[model samples]
Target: MDEMPFCVHDVLNRPLFQRAIVLAGAQGIYREVRWVHILEIIHAAPYVSKHDLILTTGLWLKRSAKSGLEYMRQIIEHQTAGLCIEFGTTVDEIPDQIIDLCDSYDFPLILFRQPVRFEEITQDIHAHIINQHFGLLKKLEQFSQQQQQLILQSTDIPAILRLLQSYSEHQILYLSRIEANTYFPPLPEEMREAINTFCNQQMKHSDQIQEMELWKMDEHRYVLIQPVVCFGQVFSYVGMLLHQAHPTEYMKLLVDYTSKAVATVLLRTQFLEEKILSNQNELIQDILNRSIDSEEQAQMRMGLPSPNGEKYIFVGGIIEFEHNVIEAGPERMESRNQDVLVLIRSLLKRDRMHHVLMMKNNQIYLLCAKARIGKDSESSLYHKIQGLIDGLNKYINQAWPHFHFHIGFGKSRTMLLDAWMSFKEAFQVIELSQTVPAMKQNHYYASIGVYQLLHAVPYPILSDFVQDQLGDLIAYENKHHLHLIDTLAMYFKCMGSKGETAKRLFIHRQTLYNRLDKISDILGEDYFQPQRRHCLEMAMLGYPLIESYHADQ
Candidate 1:
């Protein structure tokens, strides 16, 4: 959809101005000319726009010697395309000062030795501009029609993208969560990976569609990043790589239409897949809802491919999109959940993971089974699950920056009917993710450590326990604005080594001794006795809970 750029050189090529001679500033003949205008005002800066070719018989310059120089300065400063002068009637020959000024600025100056009609020149150049624009619009219409036909012919996402390469004549990069990423006409593996990394970067403001530079391209080129959004969520991206200096309105329209066409194909494909998988989906629902007590029935309902008498090892996990998603509103939240369901299924399918996925209470709940021991090992299964969470979390968080993820994987179970225990463990893991930073790295219940013991305790008792153990020390620090509690923690961290504790606290050993003495007076020296010291350490681990309790108060 590119139209030829009309410039001063093209205008002078016309037969109407055949006798025109270049008087000065011949170097800027290539300057663009969008329209032709007659200069009637002395201060023409306000009326003249860039790309305008000013035409005159030099009457304005004949007003006074000073007026001539001033008028030319306004034309150059306003960046008008050029000036055409007719050496007859009002003014005969031009002043040398004006010609020299035009030459210095490289402002194109043309002169007609014979009288020429300004009307003919304006109409002739204007007709060419109008014709080129009309052709561009017609080409855009044809491209749109072809894409619509491609959608009807096949539901393949790549089929839609192929049109982008053929028509727009640029390398096309289509990144989809639902489909394998494609490079139409294909790029080298390394370049494609580099471009993929470049495109996947999170934009500070994702809603603004713009051009991006392609890394490692020998020639200067750009990639127009256009997102494919459906149901208010972006699930894929379609980008065009070319040498355009900036994103043209034509390029924007082309990418926009192409993205929508791809979206339509993806939506239809998803609908058909959902229809085929509806029964299996219901089986997963029944397992999570505890409506089905028999693993045999679940196997039969989902049509499991496992051999006769073979028991499947099942693992359950919950991927929690924090409670704040509810603030986005109920209907919108529902749509968002459905979109996530699509994303998770796509990701699981991409990793060849055996999973039954669902969105409940704005969180993702899935049960994956190991049907083949050699094909998908336990470690491989965990790797796949972690990859699924990381990929989905990265993608969705980019679209909704405020959204965060907390994931928990349950212990593997021997039967689908007992899979609910695994799910519960996963929920505990999700809870741990909020209070335990170590839990961020450890997603399983087996690695939860002491948090498993504290998980079932009520919030009031936990907070009360922390305060009871450290109450006097906390009170002292608050009253004196001192970090005696920090000193105490560091002292414990250094294992009763006075010098190490002082070094860690950035205080002298005597200062550490003074703080320890104050603690000795406040809580009694037996606070470091084996049994009492253990309680104080656990209280320190639970310190944030009490801090949160105080904040809420």
Candidate 2:
């Protein structure tokens, strides 16, 4: 005989309740267990039904002494296990009427202090309930193990269908995928109507998962579907219609394992069939690759047509995987390819002027659409690119982490291949920008265009120019601890006016003149010399470049 299953009573005996009782002492309520039973708390009469315990504060009795007695009478009529009234709130004394009612009903009543809060008690109760549930799961698992083994070993589909029919009273259909085609077997008229409605709804909403439910046909009526995929290809779907409510957890686990076994069997069958078909399609792969290459050549030939001497600009980028990031694993690569292709297609469809292509090597090539420019054309194009980048980042970030994009825009060209040539130049420039000391040190926009050009110029040549023209003055000012560079820059900015320079620096005019005279003596040249002023101004503007050089070294 099966053992009588454990229930909440087993939970009440656990150590968690003892801990709660200890904690409650800290709140000044010393609790003594009277009786624990299930009772209904959310009912009109507040009657005890199947709950574990009932707790109350005597304040209700204190407000209307007679009603308090009547309240106890109602509780007794409900066959409650026990009652607890905390002390020091409403009723300081237990009235004889309440005691008499409790005595007649044989209900256990206990009293405690005000320190215990109801919240702590609820925690202990839930902990006990969860413990009881886990215990029940263990017992069910032990009983279902043998039945699960039989289900996996069985091969008779008809027998399995009969078993499913007995388990549920609802209309059930088996769904399977074969060679990427979804199949649904014949169903009862009512079930077919429901499924058609569900399929139509699914087709209308791309954002929702495809699922449906049918009810009120019979007791335990429901449907289950299982999808089978092997080697990244879906082959068949198996479904069942039931006439009964769903099974218990143990039974559900058995069904799931059985479904997986069936999927494995079907996969083996498909593999044998594919082996026979492969010999007939020996040249298929070669043909597909050649076709793709031909299409690419055609598109390249038509690139950016010139309209009556109008020119077009081109931009291109290669997405590089970061160090140690393997984004092209077989599973993820397929999905990524699909996603990027869809994105490019959508962008082209939305803007007819734009032409975009995805290369075999995963490089994205784009042509900047040519149009007769009005006043706001450049600004509109810039804003459009900014919005596109923001949208692309949002979509791509969902699948890949740290998706870095390097983009280069080319000058307008009338020839088709000229656009491709511009893309190549921009690509080279981006690469060169990565090497410059200043660009590398800053890291942000290190691969940008103008900064790349500035860095490409020989640093020693620029440095020599500054030193040869202003060496003596620069050295003297450095030795004397004067901000000669800043003073000179500001002085010239003020148009050689002493007072304005002093005001800008928040120093007195005399102080400015004194620094200027020291500057003249150090350089052994006139402070008013135009050549000296010109050299100093150039040096100040080149400060950032100089800093970049030093950082690289």
For each of the candidates, the C-alpha root-mean-square deviation to the true structure, in angstroms, is 6.6, 18.1
- Residue-by-residue lDDT tens digits, candidate 2, 1-553: 1111222233335443332221111211212222343322323155455332566666556556577776666665664445655566545667777776666555656555453555555566656556656765674464345334545675444444444333433233444211122223346678576654554443334222232332233454444544444444333334544444433333344345445555566555555544543431222222223332442332334343444343343333333222223645665655665455445444444445454443344444444554546655544554455455555666567545556544444444443334454455545444443443333322122235464444455778768866775677667766877787678878888898888899999998888888888777766666557876666666555555666567778
Model 2 lowest lDDT segment of ten = 22-31
lDDT, candidate 1, 1-553, per-residue tens: 3422567888889888788988999988878887899886788888899889999988887688789999999989989999999887578889999999989999999998778888998898889888866876897899889888888888877777887788777788887545566898899999988776666553333444433322333357677767776665666788887664445556667788988897788788878877756666677677767898566777666556752334667789887766454488777677767767787787888887677776668677888877646745677778888888787778687767877677889988767777888899998888667765656766898788777677666888987888899889989998996688888888888889998998888988888888999998887889889899889888876775556446657
Model 2, stretches more than 4 Å misplaced? 1-311, 314-375, 383-457, 524-532
User: What is candidate 2's TM-score against the reference?
Assistant: 0.33
Error of 1 at 136 (Å): 2.6
After the best TM-score superposition of candidate 1, give how far the Cα of residue 339 lies from its true spot, in angstroms: 7.7
Q: For model 2, what is the error of residue 502's alpha carbon versus the real structure, in angstroms, after optimal superposition?
A: 2.0
* Local distance difference test, candidate 1: 0.78
Write down the TM-score of every candidate. Answer: 0.68, 0.33
Worst 10 residues of 1 by lDDT: 209-218
- lDDT against the true structure, per candidate, is 0.78, 0.49
Score candidate 2 by lDDT.
0.49
